[model samples]
Target: MPRLIAPGSLRRIGTFFSDSGYTREALRDTLELSELPWRKLRNLHFLLHKTQEATALHQLARIFYLGQPADEALLRQCIPGAIFGLMQDAEMLEVKGGVAKPACMVAPLENLVLVSDQITNMEVELLPDLVLLPNPTTLTVSRFMLRKRGANVFDLGTGCGPLALLLAGSAKHVLGTDINPRAIEFARFNAALNGIENVDFEVGDALAPAEGRQFDLIVANPPFFVSAERQFVFCDSPLELDGFSRMLAREAPKYLLEGGFFQMMCEWVEVKGQRWQDRLDEWFTGNGCDVFVIKGFEFGAAKYAHERLFEANPLHPERDIEIFEQRLAYYRERNVTAVHGGLMAMRRKAGSNWVRIEDIPHPPKECFGDDVVARFAGQDLAAWATDEQLLDWKPALTSRVRLRQELTARDGGWQPTMQRIDLVEGLASSLALEPPVASVVCRLDGSRSVREQAAALAAEAGADAGVAQAEVLRLVRRLGSGGFLELPATG
Candidate 1:
């Protein structure tokens, strides 16, 4: 068991990864494979075709990212001499039979250097059961997570501590908790590897690790896989379908400060007889938190079970399909209809709270956390606004918003058809627009108050000013809530 990860060694290795331009795109080009081929080929594909003329990046990539072995001469050529010595001293290098093997996987994810279990590290006896690695779920939460300066943060079920390390750059303090002790150790080692000091890792159950304490921000990507049995500690949950996600959503509010935020990527069940929105709303019962949920892809029970079962036992040549069948049986017995995946954002309020459930099909080009926070603030402002008060304010279209009207061949001529408006950058929200209403929105250039613009639009449409003012007021609230328009600054 190689345990020690010296800080000096990490810094030198981190520099090498940086100078080598080690990115997903780089690897894709080097491997000469697209997404499908990459999935089919894994790391073994690289070793099976290694050439004598492999570059330094290629050798290092295979050794560090793919858990392959390289000769001492090749490692020395790829890495600086001092850094190579430091790696050997820190137990990252296992020398045997004139070949050096990497003990862990160190790769670049965005700007952070993450350390996790190698994809095919055959020294399974030394590693713990089902240790997690940096996966798409972690990347999803990381991209959407809010960063608050000088605030206390907790990462519930932190696997490799990537979220915590990223937050430590902005947060005053961070605590990462996991039930698996090996995960805690890897997280701690990664913190040192990245030279991040404001974060700490500990072994404890979800939310139990931070009991009797309140934080300004908390983010979690818990073990939400609903399973018939807890075969893997990293992904499986002992609770029923969506039981773990519901438990955290229900309990995390009590551990947050007033006006604080708790964000987590989660999956919930869509029961056969119940609406998914209503079932998810039940999770926030008795809460003082305003909830925003953005739903993503959904899967059926049998398909989900088969996919998970296949992922769990990837190295095994022979698999018992009966295990997947057994998991599907549980779902059938519980009358489960489908499984829905999404990310949820909760802001702790004083008393009154609201919930928004949406499926934004478009992906946001910018970070999502800022857009969520802005919408919540806009919602609060709208909740207290009188119709008269709302009419007095000037509103501008968001820079990220755009209007599109589909073209239809009517009478053998291409003409305008249905009009739609959507956000182009931050958060993906779209709404259909009547041509008349769309015309009115176009006139809103922030040059005048809503009262003035609506009156102008009314005159153009031959409608009464007072009547149109009320209608435009509703649009103002809708656009503001959807992050399509920027609201006026409130006192």
Candidate 2:
């Protein structure tokens, strides 16, 4: 007999998740169920959406406190058409029983996974490499490109077409390309399932050009693992070591529009004698674009080799000493003592290109990719002082303004001095004597030149005139670059 749902139990479940940081709104939106069943309230709501099966069999296993029901036969019977109907309605469902299925399935933008969808002649199991589910960082990067640029975006090596579908709403046209035909089919089926128009899926290698087409945004989360051998279908690329990065650097520019951005995650080998930043900077060569590379994570050679090899065959009993030694030697020969992974954002510019390489040594485990977008959108130093436009102009001070200096040690133990021209709040202020070097700043009054101010300050403080002059000029330049100060007009 089918177990009856308990009264008020589901509400309690919802309340529990809400208190635990999950939202009631997310459940309603993903499940497409107006209300959750009271009996299944205690069940993990995320797993229900993650599993993608209508009956929530795994969820029910715990809810009923059943010790692993022999097989899914009973669960299927109870749920009947729930998985299918849910997939039909929700558009993405996680089916638990499939052997090759990802450990967790996801429908981007929507949090639900179809855990149990019935498919004949296929064993249900989890893909070993599919440990972590796709999170908001992956989705946000894709969604931002789609929404911001819209017309013509490419989801290169589209695994499940999460980014491609997200692009459908914003982009005038979208293409989801994958090397695997199965992935292509899945992408197409997903597009159709969602009733999404203008998104086309194609089975093609990213290395190959897509028939004379260009995109405003080209996004890829390529298989960046450095492995001795390719094993997993989804995670391993045909290109080894730095192959994916090389391919992206070489090919992505051809497909991008001027000012278009190519955003991706990559793992690069850090070779000796060559700075990792320099190695990554070379990837932007040939492409007339500005590149921003953020090193998000790092792994030693041993750890990297083990992760890739383990995935290839988890049951490999023989720990071959020779094989392990050779792997370490290979990395050492290339001066690659470690593997560093990070987010790379490239913009195709019109003129003299620039590459900004930064080491984000510490990045949050979740959603570090968003930082790439933020940095790309951050204030441009050049734009701050372009001659075409100028910020607010203040009247030249006629009377000499009293300047006072106060130094304080911050939490980081760096001593920074605050230079204030007046006591007025929000007025121009400067930070001086901060570590790595000494500096000074003040408002430029048209009445007195920067040279005059430096001379006055030096005389007042009984300091070297030359030292004071250099410090004042450095501060003025920095302030001008930051849009806080501008060259005073000559009357």
Once fitted onto the true fold, the runs of candidate 1 whose alpha carbons sit more than 4 angstroms away are: 28-43, 46-55, 121-128, 315-320, 411-415, 488-491
lDDT of each: 0.76, 0.52
TM-scores for candidates 1 onward, in order = 0.91, 0.61
Tens-digit lDDT track for model 2 on 1-491?
11112213322322332232232244335444333222224543543444344344333322221111223454444443543333223333234563112222322244212111121101123343332223334543443342544568888877657777766776888888877666665565555444566888888888464658777878887777776556555666567678876789767877888877777777888777777677766777767777776666788888777655544444433655555666777677666878888767787777766565555544443333333443343323333333212222221332323455676878877554664543122222222334222322333555566667667668866779888666655554444422243333110
Question: Which 10 consecutive residues of model 1 have the lowest summed lDDT?
Answer: 32-41
TM for candidate 1 is: 0.91
- Local distance difference test, candidate 1: 0.76
lDDT winner among the candidates?
A: 1
TM-score of 2: 0.61
What does the lDDT read for residue 330 in candidate 2?
Answer: 68
Q: What are the RMSDs of all candidates, in order? A: 2.9, 10.9
Could you tell me how far off, in angstroms, the CA of residue 99 lies in candidate 1 after the best superposition? 1.2
